[model samples]
Target: MAHPLELAEPNVIDEELIRNCITTVEEISIAEDKKKEMKTETELHDIKAVSFSFQNILRIDNLNGLFSLVKLQLDNNIIEKIENIGHLVNLEWLDLSFNNIQNIQGLDTLTKLTDLSLFNNRIEELKNLKTLQNLNCLSVGNNLIRDVVHAITYLRPFRKLKMLNMAGNPCHKDPEYHMRIVAHLRDIVYVDYRLVDPEKVQQAREQYQEDLFEILEEEKKQAEDEKKAEDHQQWLDTLSEANLSGVDTLLKVMLDEDPEQGKLHHLSFWLEIIDEIQHEFKGMSKDFIDNTLNANKAKYAEKERFIDALRSSRQKSDGDSIALVGKFDLKKKKLMRQLEDLREDETVKKLRELQDLNTELNDDLLELGLRQMEADDQIVSDFERRYGDLVNAFVEAAQNGFFAKIRDLENAFHTRAVTMATDELEHFAAGQLEDVTDEAQIFLGDKDIVFASLNASHDAHLGIIDGLEDQIVTKERKTFNTLVAEARAESHTRDRKRITEIATVTARNNKEIVELIQSEQEGWNR
Candidate 1:
């Protein structure tokens, strides 16, 4: 079996395999010179994306022909250093995560890269990525990054970076790590897996602002102190030179007079000493006077400088005050003009007129509403009167018709009962006489029995018909009542709808009037 890390037949260039591995391809033609003759060479143009992730590849090589490649995924590999990828000029996305890479290098040409993933790598410092200006997303999590500030400084050139993943790195373990990173890289929207909100960024800025100001102030003070020390050293050098010359002259004069004197020389020496003392005293008095004059001159010079500074400051203040007064006068004129305009505004005058007219209009509308209500009441009363009359007439007509129908049915039933009873009695008499020896006695007894049976049957039929008529009358009365109730509900709905329409119209008119007044006021303001 072949080694798992090696590609089968590594030396062979399988065009078909390359095409299969590539996600997208384009075709193009290139000019080629063959045997001193120019020919157009057609070839598979370029691969757009290639994924060899987890392929156990040892090195990133043999990809020189993919000039237009935009994305390459080579994560989980044994590659050590980032190399051999400088030719991918159009590459925008690269994944080298989970690799043995210790340093980021050889990516100088891939300037179009917008996303780069070096997660789970041995890479330490964020370096050699300064040229990737278009980079927006970077994932270097689980790496060996230590100095957060150094990393921020290194990544500062990538101003468009919006997403950065630095989790599991040594730099991310610091206290307020997210704030530190956000404070430096304010353009980033996402750090690690956390979304950086505007409030956090603001808080970071506020938290660090005082520290930054203190640092700047300390630097300024250090510079000033250094300058003052330099000036003090120069002054000390000048004073030492003056004092050294004076001491040298006094020593020379004393040495020249000391050796020649004895006892009388001692007396002469004493007298010379007294005379020298007097001369020294006179010189001291003159030097004191000169020193006093110099001190006074220095004091006067300082006072003049102070006076000049005060005069300059006062002049500036006066100039600023004059400018402010000029501005105040201009603003006052403008305000006076605005006040005059407000006083003379035609819109305000029109508004007053409209207010007076509105009162009259409201009075007229109220009177019209009262008249409408009275008219509506009169109409309702007339409608009720008409409805009542119609109902009464319909009821009277229905009652008369129902009574006529009932009377006719009753008369018809009576006639039919009498006819049937008479026919039945005759048939019984005829049949009895045919079979009887005592015809007259038999006929009399059967006739009474037949008449009694017919009467009972007729009465039962009349009772059934009466019950059916009562049921029909009840059902008709219920149907009529239902119809009347429905009609009343419909009338009420129509009246309510009419009232709502009138109210809506009134409200709309009022809104329009208010809007007109507001528009007029706005126009005047403008």
Candidate 2:
């Protein structure tokens, strides 16, 4: 063999160095292939996000294979008919603004979508978006949303919705449309990019609380007032009924008495009041007492005049008053003589006619008197029959009963008028009980207290009722004011939400612009 060292070195050392080099190259190649495959999987199967905005990018059809995509943005694109976008099952965000979309059917199957923007599109109707329950922001501005109310209704599934933009649309032309939108839309704070003020919202809340409180207070007051009015009216009704019953009882008692007794009792009752007044007047101011006494005296004088006239007429007409009888006999004789003269002489025809006329007049007058007598007799008998006992009782009372018993007292007062101050005043005040008090006294006091109690009690009761009514009116006004304030507050809230959404969109567009510029710069550098 060749020298051992030389042969071994030539065969083993160089070959081993070459084999190690090949093995190293092979390992490097394998690692490179694995890395390439990993990168390919990451790019094709693990797409986390995608955005294409405000660029000359014409289409998105090539992205259909991105099944693992989570977000897709194609804003400011001149695309049309957002078709086949439902193929993106994993997509959560989709923005295809500045397009020619006419309907919202493309977003129907995007159940997991939380954000979707289709601004500056030609969409006239929003349909088939009922499944987007997780949507938070939806921008469909610069489009023809004719029936925005219907669109909002259809989008009820999106309970988490926070932002909506429909500016530059015809629907905003309605004066109350935005306010109603704020009312119906859940969680939306603004409309057409307008924002609400926080201070205003707090004020509105305070106003609403005040309103609610006012309403409650008012209702309570109204209830109390009604109750009080009912009680007062019932009390008055009861008093009126009692007065009617008392009057009826008094009338019956008077009717059962003899007419003279009835008249005497009535006069005595009035006379007692007069005596009381006279007694009270000794201690009272002279002028007031004198005026009251004079008025009563005038009333009594009129009653006496009426009684005197009736008595005079009755006495004059009592029987045997016969001027009419005397005249009738005289006329009868004259007529008889004239008839005799007419029978003897034919030239006495006029006299005979006159006699006959006079006879007829006499007969008529006699018949009339006979009827009057019969009527008078019937009247006297009927009067005695119906009221004979009443007359007797009256006569006895006037001559020897209650009047007789009080007559001595009156005579004593008249005789001792120089020493009669205390007794009369007491009597006058006591007699006023029936004329004044209706219900039992709630409190015991003197005459002044009684008078003050009646008047002051009425005023106090009415005051309470009036206070309740005022409370009711105040509360009602507060409630209405609160509602109006809430409405305006809600509108502002919606406006804020809309403004925030628009700002966010604008910020995103700006960011996209930066990214596009960087990408362009990087491409240029490459």
Candidate 3:
């Protein structure tokens, strides 16, 4: 562990720093130790990246010769302006974040750029990005952008864009910004670091479809108009061809009675009229059931089937919750086992190893001290001076230097063991935290799914009930229309007069029914 990066963190962009970084191989991280070494040989035309980040640089400079550079990281600097890098036409990824850039300029030539970040800057408006047609990601977060309309107007062109982060901006404070972004940019996958839900996107488009229409470019507008025209044509065709069982046909006939009055509603709003007519039509809710004070016996049976379905769906959810709980229990038990192993087994084993090492060191020290003392005695007592003096000198050198060396080595060994143990514990803790967080999120997501499914089932059952009522009303309307047609056709004498009387009575009855149903519907809606 020694860090090889510069200590002074030079605040200026210069050639020396550039050359050193390009020539020296970046040290591999733990996660990347198995990967091939990064080639740092400075080949000007072949270089792919120049990382000048976290250099305390005040400005971007000295990047003149690197023509093939694709990634340039110049973030975390105080650079006040974007300049002198327009020659890097091959650049695809550029990050000049944590700077003071006010206006988005000098990037018009970078048509191949796909990702760009000017986060934490002073940009007030989003502009000068008409040429970055290939961009798929953009981040201008924590900036000074104020007008959402202006920002969206500029961002809408790059149709290839999928990810956008404009969080921490003044304009993002408004909740409508999120809705508007979803409505206008339907293709984006992520906005402000959150996934764009398709359901929300549909609702937003419906809410703001009119506004979105006016701002669409000519080509897009033409495409939309063509689609609408095609759909409208299909709707007219369906009206003519459909033997509609419901009041859809009857309502059209009533509305079309006056030749001067024509269709004035879209298909969606026209459904409301059908609904009102269905409600006003008499004997609508009575089905094949026999005449009794009650009409819901068959309906109740239908509901029972739906209830069974709902019950089955809930049972499945319950089983999943049970499995999830079991998983949680297993995780809890596994964590307990891990704690026991770490605290009681592994910790004790490591402590014992350290104790044994200390004991061995002390034993060696004691033996050396005894040998030195014995040599000292022998030299002082009767012995040949040459051998005794040689033994004495050897003993003294071993006593001081050997003891200090052994002590230093022992301390180093202990330090290494402690560091390794701590690293292992920290890694284990982080992994466990991640696992728990994932489990929590999974459970939360499952809960959302469960609730959403249950609600959908309820809505579906209610719809089935309404469908049965509509079917009964449709049968009634069909029968009445069939009888009227037969009665008019059968009359050979004064057929016109009879048809006129029958039509007049039908129109009056339809008028009174429409009024009553409209009142009921208004009150019900309120």
| Stronger candidate by TM-score (2 vs 3) | 3
Candidate 1 or 2, higher lDDT? 1
The order by descending lDDT is 1, 3, 2
Summarize candidate 1's per-residue lDDT along 29-132 as a digit string, tens digits.
Answer: 33443411311222334567766766666667767777878888887766677877798898998999987789899998889999999999888898888889
- Give stretches of model 3 more than 4 Å off: 1-10, 23-40, 217-526
Q: Sorted on TM-score, highest at the top, how do the candidates line up?
A: 3, 1, 2
lDDT at 386, model 3? 34
Taking the candidates one at a time, how many backbone clashes does each contain?
0, 11, 0
Across residues 1-526, which tens digit of lDDT does each residue of candidate 3 receive? 2122233454666666665444222333433322223343455677777677777677677788889888888887767889888999999999899876888888989898999999988899988899898999999999988888788777877799999999999998987898888888757899988999999999988889888878766658778999999997775564332212332333233334423122112112234543554454322212211121132243334336544543454355446534543554454355435534563445444434433443443344344434433433343232223323433433343334332333343344334433543443344445532333443344323433433433443344334334533554455446445633543343333334434543454345345434544554565568
| Candidate 2 lDDT by residue in tens digits, 1-526 | 3222222222211222212212110123457665445434454445555555544334345455557767776665556566666778887878788765676676677788987888877888777777888888888888998776677666644668878888777886766566546555546765566765455445544545664466458768988999999997875564332221121122223224323322222221334544563454333323322333344354345436544543454344333224444554465466556544443344244334444544554454445444444444454344334333433333343335322333343344333431232343344456633333222222222444433433443344334333433443344345445634553454356445534543454345345434544554565578
lDDT of 3 at 142: 98
Error of 3 at 340 (Å): 87
User: Candidate 3, 323: how far from true, in Å?
Assistant: 82
- TM-score for each model: 0.36, 0.30, 0.38
Candidate 1 lDDT (Cα, 0 to 1): 0.59
Candidate 2 lDDT at 270 equals 38
The models' CA-based lDDT, in order, is 0.59, 0.50, 0.57
